[model samples]
Target: MSNGKPVYKLIDGKGRVLIPKELRSAAGMDYGDIVRLGVTNGRVSIRKIDIIEVGDQSPDAVKAYVRAAFKTMPDDTRLSLIAELTELLKQKKEV
Candidate 1:
C-alpha cells in the first residue's frame, strides 16, 4: 500500500525477506564487512565500516592516519583525537 521503496513479502511458513541483490551491490556490502546503522533527527543513514588492513595496524601508520583525519575535520567540531592525545600526554607529564 506504500508508494515508497519496493517492499518484499515474507514467504513460506517462516517470515523471511531477502535483501535485493541489486541493492546489495549498490551499497558495496559483502559477506564479511561490518555495517553501522543509526538514526538522527528522524533521518536514517547507513555507512559501511572501514576495513583496516594488516599493514595499517601498526602504531605509526595508525597515528599518521589519525593526524590526517584531524587535519580535514570541520572547525565547528572541537572533538579531535589530536587534542585528546595532547591532554593525555600532559596528564602523563604531571604524574
Candidate 2:
C-alpha cells in the first residue's frame, strides 16, 4: 500500500506535535523545515513543509520530475497522464 497519510497527535509537554516517522519520510521532511497549519471545511490539515511551486524550480527539473512521475503508469493511464501533465505544465508556466 502507499504510505499512510500524516496524522497529528496532541502536543507533548514540550509543545511539540509528534509526527509519525513514516509520514515524515513519505513527505520528505527533514528536521527544522517549517510546517503550516490550516483549517478548511472544518478539517485540520498540517503540511509537513511548505512546498515550492514550479516557479521556484528549474524548467528542466520540472520536466524531469514530470517524466519520472508518469513513467511507471500502466499502458491504460499513459494518455490520461499526458493530458494531465500538459494541463499542469500550462498552469505552472502561468504562475
Candidate 3:
C-alpha cells in the first residue's frame, strides 16, 4: 500500500467510493470508525477521527488531558481543530 503507486477506484452511482482494504489498513481505518473528509483544490483527504472521553473529570484534569493530547497532534490537525473550536466559540458568542 505504501509503494507510491496510485490505486484507482470507481465511484458508485450513489457517489460512494470504496477504500481498498490495504489502504484502509495503512491508514488505521476500520469498520465503524469515524472519519473526517476534507476537500481542497480538487483533492479529497480522509482522516480517522480519534475520540476521547472526559466524562465527570475535573476542569483542571480535563485541561491537563487536552494539553497532553494537543502536544502530540500533527500541526495541520492542531490548526484545523483550533479553527473548528474558534468557529464554535464565535457561534456561541453570537447566540
- Residue pairs with backbone atoms closer than 3 Å in model 2 (clashes): none
What TM-score, to 2 decimals, does candidate 1 have? Answer: 0.34
Q: Candidate 2 at residue 78, lDDT?
A: 94
lDDT of 2 by residue, 1-95 (tens): 14455454798899777776677777776565545567999986777534434464667445545555555568779988778989999999999
- Per-model clash counts, in order, read 0, 0, 0
Which candidate number has the best lDDT? 3
Q: lDDT per residue, candidate 1, 1-95, as tens digits? A: 13347655565667444556666677786654444456999965556655434575777557645655555578755466558879999999999
Instruction: Score residue 8 of candidate 1 by CA lDDT.
Output: 58
For all predictions, the C-alpha RMSD in Å is 14.6, 13.0, 14.0
Q: Model 2 reaches what TM-score against the true structure?
A: 0.38
Cα lDDT of model 2 overall?
A: 0.65
- How much does candidate 3 score in TM-score? 0.51
lDDT of 1: 0.60
Off by over 4 Å in 1: 1-18, 51-95
**TM, every model:** 0.34, 0.38, 0.51
Off by over 4 Å in 3: 52-95
lDDT of 2 at 34: 44
